[model samples]
Target: MLRIATCQMTSGPDIGANVQIAESLIRKAAREGANLALLPEMFTIMSNDPKDVLRLAEQYQDGPVQRIMSGLAKSLGIWIAAGTMPLKTDDPHRVTNTMLVYDAFGQEAARYDKIHLFSYEGQQERYDESELYVGGHKTVSFNLPLENGLDIRIGLAVCYDLRFPQLFRRQSGIDCFLLPAAFTTNTGKAHWEVLLRARAIENLSYVVSAAQAGRSSCGRAFWGHSCAV
Candidate 1:
């Protein structure tokens, strides 16, 4: 069996600090003999202002975050399923919530933009991800070659996409699912674990998830509990 790790974090407005924490966790995972490491959604920054996200968004290849992940994956000799990051889009006003995977050699292996934008309105919380992110239209998956000479088909997905089963269904022969999320406290308490378990059972594949935990600098609470099933 392939050993995998899911890293949870409570990201704040400080991008540098968040990156440091992510790097540390990834190193720990590698030390523990994990073949692949997964990070939580928006592990780079979580802010109360949409403008901050826009300001920090980077192009796919030019971003410092990409460089960090690539270096770590290469150094650790492991695959890294980086969590969602804000990517610059053609529309200056909007960004894409993109998940990027780096191979053992630190090369970009695959990319998947979040397909479903999260919009929630409740008595205690309100969020509209569509305001800042552009939804992606295609499904992405890749084959990961293991040391045992086995190739595992892995599917990529982000927070909101987990809510849509059809998205997972499109990835026909995936052996595992990597989902990175920053789920709100209210909705996560109601649906997070149940949905993850259901997906695993339905797809007959292993599911791994990394998530934001506790409270963020923006004062939003998340349900952390990163796990594999």
Candidate 2:
């Protein structure tokens, strides 16, 4: 059996501090013999100001964050599902919520951008990702060679994408799915676990999810029951 673990993190607005937390968890997971590890969405930074993302977004290829993740994966000799990060896109002001996968050698294996955008309106809350994030155009997956000659195909998705079953259904041959999320306290209490379980049962695939838990510096709270099904 493959050992997999997901980290439930509480990321703030500081890039250095966040990366340090990520590194600590990665080390712990590696020591536990986890073959694959996952981090939560916005593991780097979460800001109330949309402008912060544009300021933090990096070009697709080279960046300090990318280098750190790649190097850490290589050092630990494990596959990493790096959750969602802000990636530069063609649009000048917007970025892509992307999942970057790295192999044991620190080589990037695949990248999946979150296709669905989130919109919510409540008495005290309002959010629309379309204002800051660009939507992805394709489904993403990668295959891992297991010890017994079994190649497991895994699909990638982000937080809001969990609400859309059709997107996961379209990716055939996936034996497992990875979702990294920052679910709000209100939504998580009502729908998070139910939706995650439904997706796994419907797809007949292993689902591993990492989430942001607790209150963030941005004044937002997340529900953090990070689990696998």
Candidate 3:
């Protein structure tokens, strides 16, 4: 069986501290013989203020976070999926929630910008990702070449994309799907497991998800049940 690890995190507003925590977890996963490692959504920063994301957003090719992940992947000889990092886009009001994939050699292999924007409102809760992020234009997938001559195609997706099964339908050739979500406690209790199982059952593919759990620095709570289905 293929080995993989999905991290459950509680990220804060501090980017440096978050990265340190992520690196530690990644190392642990690699040491455990995980061929592929997945991180949670907003793994680097989870600030209440959207503007903070823009400030932290970095260009795709050159960024401290990207460099670090690439280096780690190469050193460990594993595939690292740096799950949603804020990326610089043309719109100052918005950032791209991009997932960067690095090969065993520390080379950039693929990238996926989160396509679905999240918008929800309750009597006491509300959030609109479109206000601070623009949707991605294309679907993203990559191949994981294994030693046994078995190459697996993995599809890429983020939090809200789970709500739209059609988006996953378009990724016909993928052998697995990676989802990184920061789902709230309220919603996670209501729909998280059902949705994940549905995606896997419908697509006939494996689903690896990492999520943020517990109360965050922003006072928002997440329901974390990171798992593979």
Candidate 4:
């Protein structure tokens, strides 16, 4: 069996500080013999202001976030599924929330921009990610070669994508799904694990999740229950 690790950490508006924390956690996981390290969504920043995301957004391949994670994966000798970071686009008003996967040698293996943008309006909380993010239109999956000379197919999904099962259904023979989330406390408490379980059951595959577990810069609580199966 392959060893998978899900990192649970807090994020703030400061990307540098968040990267430090993320690196430290990934190093610990490596020391503990984890073959793969999955980071939580918005692992770098949790800003209340949309402008913060716009300001922090980096270009697809040349950004600091991608460079650092690529080096980390090579140096640490572990596959890293970097949860989600802001990538610049043609639209100045919006960015793409993207996941970049790096292999053990640090090469960029695959990229998946999140297709589902979450827009929630509740009594206490209101969010419209569509204003800040443009949705991705494609499904992405890749093959991971194990140490045993065998390879497993892995599918990708981000935070709000979990709610739609049809997305997962489109991909065939995915051995496991790499999901990174920053679910709100209320929704996560009620639906997180159950939904995860249901997805696994429906696909007859494994689901690995890494999540943010604390409050955002605006004091909105996140439901963090990182797990793998």
Candidate 5:
């Protein structure tokens, strides 16, 4: 049996501040005996400014952000499903929203770029990520090796990707789906719990989610209910 911890966070544009909070929560999870911990999407920084994405986007395997996460996993002796971070892409103008998973030994385990970029146009709130993020094409999954000698298969997905069932269906025999998200207050209120429940019911698999809730540093409201089932 795997003990998992999903963190509920309220992040802002300050990368340093966000990382510190995440580290504290992760350490707390490890202390509480969580074998695996997941963070919310855009945990690095939920910026209202698009330039922050470009200013901070690092190459997939390189950069200070990646180094810190690897160290946290190794030193803490825990598995970390790192929430999505901005990754530099071939396109100089845009970056790929990427997720990185690290093993207890501080080694890279798997990587997934968010395939579904959110595009929502509400009367009050409008977001078009396509302008800043390059969509990812492939699905990704990895197995967690346990001391019990049973490896658990876990699939990877970012926030908006949860809206598309086809993405989850693409991975077979997944014991759990790791989702990291920061849903806008309006949309999340209408469908967050409903969708999460539906996904769990449809897949017959556990759904673990980390969320960004409340008012962010950017002053944007989020639907901050992190859940696992």
Candidate 6:
């Protein structure tokens, strides 16, 4: 079996601070012999203000986030399935919520932009990710070569995408699913675990999820139970 780890964090608006936390967690996971590590969505920044996210958006290849993840993967000699980060797009008002995977050698192996944007309105809270992010149009999957001379197919997805089973269904022959999420307290408490387990059972593939926990700089509380099944 492939050893994997998922990290939960209380990310804030400071990109540098968040990266440091992620690095520390990744190092811990590596020391424990984890072959792969998955981080939470928006692990580099979490803010309710659109300006904060926009200010932090960077080009996929040239951004500090990518550089940090790549260097960490290479240094630790482990694969890193980085969580969703804001990547600059053609539209200045919007960015892509993208996931980047790095191989042990620090080369980017695959990238998946989040396809489903989350929008919720309730008496307690309201959120509309579409205001800041442009949803991606494609499904992405790649193979991870294991030490046993076996290659495992991994499908990539982000938070809201977990609610859309059709997306996972489109990726056939995947051995596992990686979901990086920042689920709200209300919805996560009600649906997170059930949905994750359902995806694993229905697809007959293992599911790994990393999530943001506790309160964020935006005053939003996240459900922090990052897990795998």
Which candidate's lDDT is highest? 6
Backbone clashes in model 2, listed as residue pairs? none
- All-Cα superposition RMSD per candidate: 0.8, 0.9, 0.9, 0.9, 0.8, 0.8
Candidate 5 lDDT, 1-229, residue by residue in tens: 7999998889888999998999999999999999899999999988878998799899878899899989999999999999989999889889988899999989999999999999888777789999999999999999998888999999999999989998888788999999999999998999898888888888989999999999986988999889986
Q: Which regions of candidate 1 deviate over 4 angstroms?
A: none
lDDT string, candidate 6, 17-85, tens digits:
999999999999999999999999999889878888999999979988899999999999999999989
How displaced is residue 171 in candidate 6, in Å? 0.8
lDDT computed for candidate 5: 0.91
Question: What TM-score would each prediction reach against the true structure?
Answer: 0.98, 0.98, 0.98, 0.98, 0.98, 0.98
Model 6 residue runs over 4 Å out of place are none
The residue pairs that clash in candidate 6, if any, are: none
Per-residue error (Å), model 4, residue 5: 0.8
Tell me the tens digit of each residue's lDDT in model 4 across 1-229.
Answer: 5788899978989899999999998899899999889999989778998999999999999989899999999999999999999999999999999999999999999999999998888899998889899889999999999878999999999989999999999999999999999999989999999999989999999999999997777587999989875
Candidate 1, 39-105: lDDT as tens digits = 9999998998999999999998898999999999999998999998999999999999999999999
C-alpha local distance difference test of each model: 0.92, 0.91, 0.92, 0.92, 0.91, 0.94
Let me know the TM-score candidate 1 reaches against the reference structure.
0.98
Report the lDDT tens digits of candidate 3 across residue range 17-103: 999999999999999999888999989999998878989999879899999999999999988889889999888778899899898
Off by over 4 Å in 4: none
Number of backbone-clashing residue pairs for each candidate, in the order shown: 0, 0, 0, 0, 1, 0
Backbone collision tally, model 5 = 1
| Candidate 3, superposed: residue stretches over 4 Å from native | none
